[model samples]
Target: MEDVNPRIAGHYDELAELWDDIVASPSRERLLWETFEGLLPDLEGKRVLDAGCGSGFYAARYVERGAEVTGIDLSADMLERAREQVPDAEFVQADLTQPLDFLDDDGIDVICCQHAFSHLEDLSVPLSEFARVLVDGGVLVVSTHNPVHDYVVVREGEYPTETMPGDMEATVETESATPVYDETERYDIVWNSGPDSNRATYYRRSIEGLFSPVLDAGFEIRDVVEPTPDEAFTRENPEIAAGFKQDAAKSVCLKAVR
Candidate 1:
């Protein structure tokens, strides 16, 4: 697999300082966390690997639940912030698309990779690595951009789309819309934090294409969740919440057992 970590790392380096505010948005973080938390196994005394652990937000939560947490990310700047946020947990700068040399086979009890897969060109390598590191019956929790949602967004052009950054190139085929749901494509996703905008490349895949790699990697799929905004989000942003519920899910969360 081609290494896209340097480019991805550069994109996140700029967003590291604003990461907290970016995810703190009710529409994204609140919905994601609520869904991911519900799928977590008993974490106490477990060995948890926080893959693509940006700023240790989720790692801290894992630690709070009494799990021994190790966080890995491509961005050194993000890892630095993660270390500060969760000093109790170990943080390493590593690429998800490569072998996890730092971990032993069947050593991890849980692997949490939240909103990170979109950056990768292929899922097989990482899923295989996850399977390698996770003990039998260990849990794997992942959250990523919902392909159905991306299709709707691109077809309707209801959401704002940005150009790929000049220095960062998309490795996969880039398409605004595909005739079939099975075609995987790369997209330029923009996130606005106040007046500043940060753009990154994301790969959109069909539901089947997304999960097939997991099954192929020897994981038994458990639960697949399309998270809806809760009452708290509805109370804060009624219009957005209504749109979220009425439209396709913005993200899909999956829980699988190794």
Candidate 2:
């Protein structure tokens, strides 16, 4: 765990510029934001925690919706960009896998962790921290890479990759290596940022393995959403949209209440 955070942080630091472009794509994140935001309660005057908040993309939205947002990320470079981009929100360099000592018990109204769970080996640690920090009946919104989609990606060895082209062009590409997807284990994935690519480690877990920790941490599951591409995504990247509907969703979002 000690070495993993640094490597993950380094990967983000290197790709921070490219990531800014990728996260800004409306076609890529529209459905994800819809699903994530649809589950939240009123954000007006609420204290929101954007856990593993890379570059403050969602934190900006939370602030716009009248929430007091605090964003945390492991990458210093990402935090720097986040601070610059969202001046109203607080940015902190913190690790989700460790205890979040900066926060007090039952202090947060909502916690949103998006696309960050894949980097952690165990979900229990972070989920426990979330439960501890969230007041009773508080909301927890999380999104992660879909294990079902990962299973197909590993079995097929090829997938329709979404690139940062203005039109969001997707092409079927073959993977150099395919890792086992059935077991709960850590594996490396090559993330492409436009012309540049880098390898980062991620955990692949079964659906049961994914949600058991949330339940154990005393969160009552409210909704599990598999977000489909929006109309713009379908119009720009029809082939990729078709493949996603035919096989599995690329990501799954969950809303839980403490």
Candidate 3:
């Protein structure tokens, strides 16, 4: 159950162009695209489905709000920068932990999956392939990593506060590897992204591992949010909005439905 897509596709294929320059830097992405554009919805003709679509950065804003996007991912160098940023959407090269089969069933209507749902090792196999290609009132959204404010970091603790009881090797630029969790899997974390060493890994869960497998893969939650730092992102980072108003919600955003 720990495939972890070849070291999460060699850590985003080595930070695919510094992650599209920190998502087009708005003073280092503070209002994360105006809090994911108020959790989207009225995407004109809908159909959406950006699922893990990394470099497309919310699939070129859901194809400039007229929807009908597609975008999938798993880094073919972040789908060649999400097909040069949504050149009329539809860039594939899938693998959201497998089994999408080029979509069909209900045939989508909206999925999103921004911060790639904590880089899933298993989230009921992409929430049961997003409830078999959505459609019944479809609407997923997702965004993640807020297991008590992005795995409880306060400073200088250098990860592994309690999870590694077996496999180890983390290093990175000096080259060690093997990360995807160990100690009976205390929700995986592994770091090294900023200074270029590039070793990444995600999964943190717990908020019932992020909404009980999307309510047992059927979906219906509706809205959860938790995002903050607005006032022009707390005046362009007041110490990261005062450590995000004293921690515990570095990001959450949910929405569901299907």
Candidate 4:
């Protein structure tokens, strides 16, 4: 188990302003928002939950669609930034590690976790709880870090060193820093400026990891989507876009129902 709080919150606070820039562009975020929105059964007047809603990117979009949206996350700084970014929506600072505390059983219509689900160490517990929280047949939307490309690319000034592993899977490790403030672990950021540095204690999920525990959690996997530039972007930069596509390593969206 990672610290699951305070430390992750701290790191996000440190990177709050630039998190989106480093993650993806506005257009890409829009595409992702639309992708997640399409996963829902319907949007208007639905009670939606934005789990790990960093900076409220997808949160705002859901609110725009007339969904009663509540954005929850481990980072207060994140919720703060989200509040400013989308003041109309409600924000809750909470951890996704255990069970979501504020939500009730069978109360939510849809839940969206963008680029957030893949970071957990213990999926069985939380996923089960997630299913518990959702109304019968309600959808649980999870977006994961496509491990291949996400763990590849080594841009300078981004991290400690540039080393691309031949294998596609990633290993989870922890910090020896005394007392280990949150038991937080680290993933080597592929293109980071910090030498020998790694992103703190977050897990990168695999395909099997996606579905196995999902079934175990009593949910059915309805769809798995890999977000790309669509045919249009792929046509303009066939090689480049295809290269990005080749990895299947960027992100994956899984729509599951209880």
Candidate 5:
């Protein structure tokens, strides 16, 4: 928890210029978008909701495809940058852990959230809210770090100081549990400043990618795609590019229809 809401927003506001370049580097996100492209059935006049839409990169693609798009984020700074790049999208600011303020009941045709889940203390509430905002038979697409493919590589283990060119594999399995963040929350992590500070993220997910929520939310799993990148990702890691035939390095795609 941060007390500096204004500073938090300002940090992103100041950092907004390099936001896209920093996150989508080597174009892995194009693969993420290709996953969305595969999931969208048809969007000639559909209404789409992009939750946690940081900078509207995903929303702009939907808008271009003729879907009316609304995007929401917790950071007003990110929303500002999104507005500059994607003027046609409806962008707003809202806390994702709570019910949304800007949406109407059964008003959305599709729900798309990327790199945003598991940031909250719990998944059940937001999952329910996603169902509430969507019309019946609509869709929800969520892309996340594939806990299935590479959890042990990230925890209770080590990576080379640099990612070397090789087939990296480990047989170790890890399980992560997410409980509401009470004052008594516990972690065994050893915290430090340098690599840990800038690179640290706080939440964890259930093992490997599971589908309990889609069933609970009443959406059917349509497709789970690990889409290929547009030229940039392949150039960075030819091995990784081909391995999409098997798994993803940092993220996985989940497409469910309401």
Candidate 6:
């Protein structure tokens, strides 16, 4: 567990320079924001924790909503960028797989983990820690790739290559867990930023494997949302739009209450 965080952190640290460009038109994240927006309680004067808050993209939104936000990330480089992106919020360099010692019991009202949740090799301790820190009835919102759409393959002859292109399709299957992240279940992501590209790895867990820990941590599942891109975004990117319409949206959101 200790080594996993550093390995993942190092990868993101390397991509820090090109992170924004690669995710410039992040439609997938837009869908997650839409799903979480309605379910989130009033943020005004509330304490919000953006767990695994990379680059402060979502943390800035919380700050705009009047929440006193704290954003934490494993990568120092990512934390540096997050601080710059959301100067008003507090940024901390921390590992998710370890105890969040900086926070006290029942200290937070809401915890949000965006695309970063899937990076955790184990969820038990973190979920328990979330339960410990969140006030009763507090919300925990997370977005991850849906296991149904885990059918992903590297392009032919792409192996032993540094990066993969952007013109790839993600398929869906229910039969077995797809090793998008390789044998150990870590996904090799080639993030493209203009002419430059960067690589990062992420874990892929089955639907049941992903949510069972939350339930075990005493969070009542409140909402399970499969969001589609908004009309404007969809029109701008028709290929991605078609996948959502075909029920192949690779991402999903879960809202739970402690």
Candidate 2 structure lDDT? 0.81
Q: Kindly list the per-residue Cα lDDT of model 6 for residues 160-257, writing each as its tens digit.
A: 21112344322222223434433225555554432222445566666778888899999999988877778897777787677567655666888999
How do all models score by TM-score? Answer: 0.87, 0.88, 0.31, 0.76, 0.72, 0.81
The global C-alpha lDDT for each of the candidates, from Candidate 1 onward, is: 0.81, 0.81, 0.69, 0.65, 0.63, 0.73
Off by over 4 Å in 5: 1-15, 156-200, 208-210, 227-236, 239-248
Tens digit per residue, CA lDDT, model 1, 160-232: 2211122332222235544356877666645443222245666777888899999999999999999887787
lDDT of 3 by residue, 1-258 (tens): 557677777677766766766666553255555666777789899888888787887687778888888878877888887887678988888888889997998988888887787767578998999899988988888767666654353121234311122243343121123322221122333443344334566655557767888999988898887777778767865765776676655667788887
Which regions of candidate 4 deviate over 4 angstroms? Answer: 1-4, 20-27, 147-186, 190-198, 235-242
The alpha-carbon RMSD values of the candidates against the true structure, listed in the order shown, are 4.6, 3.5, 17.5, 6.9, 6.5, 5.2
Off by over 4 Å in 6: 22-26, 151-184, 190-198, 230-233, 245-247
lDDT, candidate 5, at 21:
62
Clash count list over all predictions: 0, 0, 1, 16, 3, 2
Better of 1 and 4 by TM-score: 1
- Using lDDT as the yardstick, the better of models 2 and 6 is 2
Q: Write the per-residue lDDT of candidate 2 for residues 94-185, one digit (tens) a residue.
A: 89989999999999999999999988988999999999999999999999989887666655644445535454333323333555555676
Residue 210, model 4, lDDT? 56
Q: Weakest 10 consecutive residues, lDDT, candidate 6?
A: 155-164
